[model samples]
Target: MTLVAIVLGAAVRPDGEASPTLRLRVEHAVALYHRGAVAAVCVTGGVGRHGPAEAEVAARLAMSLGVPERDVILEDRSRTTVENIAFARPLIGVHQVVLVSNRWHLPRAWVVARILGVRASVSGPRGRMSTSRTIAATLREVAALPSTVWRAWILSKRSAPKPEPRAR
Candidate 1:
């Protein structure tokens, strides 16, 4: 199965540039593309306090870094990790995916993907943040875990087929 790198959006600067975290994610995906690990890179995120969507910024970065535009798919209407993978699934058009995000986020993302029945392998960028930023992000991820799972569960239930009512 061909693998697609699903680069989850982090944040975009108000100036419409990719955040450091976002850049790291996109760069990592591009590296994977160069290494011939993935057939394409699917960048996912919606507009968040910015004009261009997060995926757009990440896609541009990937293209600038030499990943061909034709090989970059965009899912530009997702505001969360669940939405990221969910929205990108059709665009990816493959069973195998590489979920790309920060180290702290990959665990939750992997869980959510599996719960949603997405066959995924997780990968984090080789990058570092300031101590304060790392601590803040770690705390945020810890707090987000339960809600993330709950949301994924809800979405999974919604997508599941409902049984037909038995005739009396």
Candidate 2:
């Protein structure tokens, strides 16, 4: 099976710089690649408050960390966890994805993946964020869970084919 590391998006500063969370996700994905755990790294995100898309930033970091350009797949048009998985699915094509994000973010991401009918595993950087940031992120995850699920449900419905009208 083709294994891919899906580096989920994080905040990019307004000046187009990567936030620590974004760097962490990309580093973990690159580590997985260097260790031969995955064949490609698919970074996902569209422009947020920043000028450059999160995926674009992560893709550049992945390359700078030794992941070849060809092995970096960029899905630079998704702004949420649901859209992240949804948008990246086609580009990822028949791969078992390993979602890479901060530890606090993986649960919702996994939920989004399962709702999208994508079988995915998750990996996070071993390093820990500062306590305040961790608490804040955890709370954010808790608050975002419902909306994430709702969006995933909507996306799944939209992507699902309508059954042919029963033979008239």
Candidate 3:
């Protein structure tokens, strides 16, 4: 398999540290690097209101994990799921990809990848900071599902091939 890229979702911290979720994603990317499965890693996320951009933090973490700086691609402008997929397209060339993120964000992330025409699978981190945070994130994702689906649908439509005419 030609695994070209691994996409990591950023997690923000209140104290300007990389969140646990983001760290897990970086760990996963590092594992991929060890396995030689992916040629490069794409870290996606913009700065939060209180912290540095998630993608930049992720890229730094990956480098610290022994991934070469050249192998890390940064999509440091995205603040949402849709922008994550959209912004990473030019940086990702692999047909198959492993997407890493929090479990609560998988559905939207996977949908966005599909919309972008990448064959992708999601790996989510286990553990929770608090039940309330988990519940809230899940509920918010559920509420956003319709809009996510709509965005994917629009993207797919725009990228789909035109139908040929029937023979006379």
Q: For this target, which candidate reaches the highest lDDT against the unseen true structure?
A: 1
Which residue pairs overlap in candidate 2's backbone? none
The reply for model 1, stretches above 4 Å from the true place, is 163-168
Ranking by lDDT: 1, 2, 3
Residue-wise C-alpha lDDT for candidate 2, range 1-168, written one tens digit per residue: 889999999889877878988998898899999999999999999999876999998898999999999999999999888989999999989646899998888999999999999999989986577789889989999999998899899999999878988886
The C-alpha TM-scores of every prediction are 0.93, 0.93, 0.80
Q: List residue ranges in candidate 2 displaced over 4 A.
A: 164-168
lDDT of 1 at 25: 92
Global lDDT of each candidate: 0.91, 0.90, 0.78
TM-score, ranked from best to worst: 2, 1, 3
What's the residue-level lDDT of 32 in candidate 2? Answer: 94
Q: Model 1, 45-152: lDDT tens per residue?
A: 999987699999999999999999899999999999999988898788897899999988898999999988899999998659888988898899889989999999
lDDT of 3 by residue, 1-168 (tens): 756455555667887778887888788777877789777788888887756899888888889989898888888888778777767776776667777777888877888788778788876667456999989989999999889878877877886778999999
Pairs in clash, predicted candidate 3: none
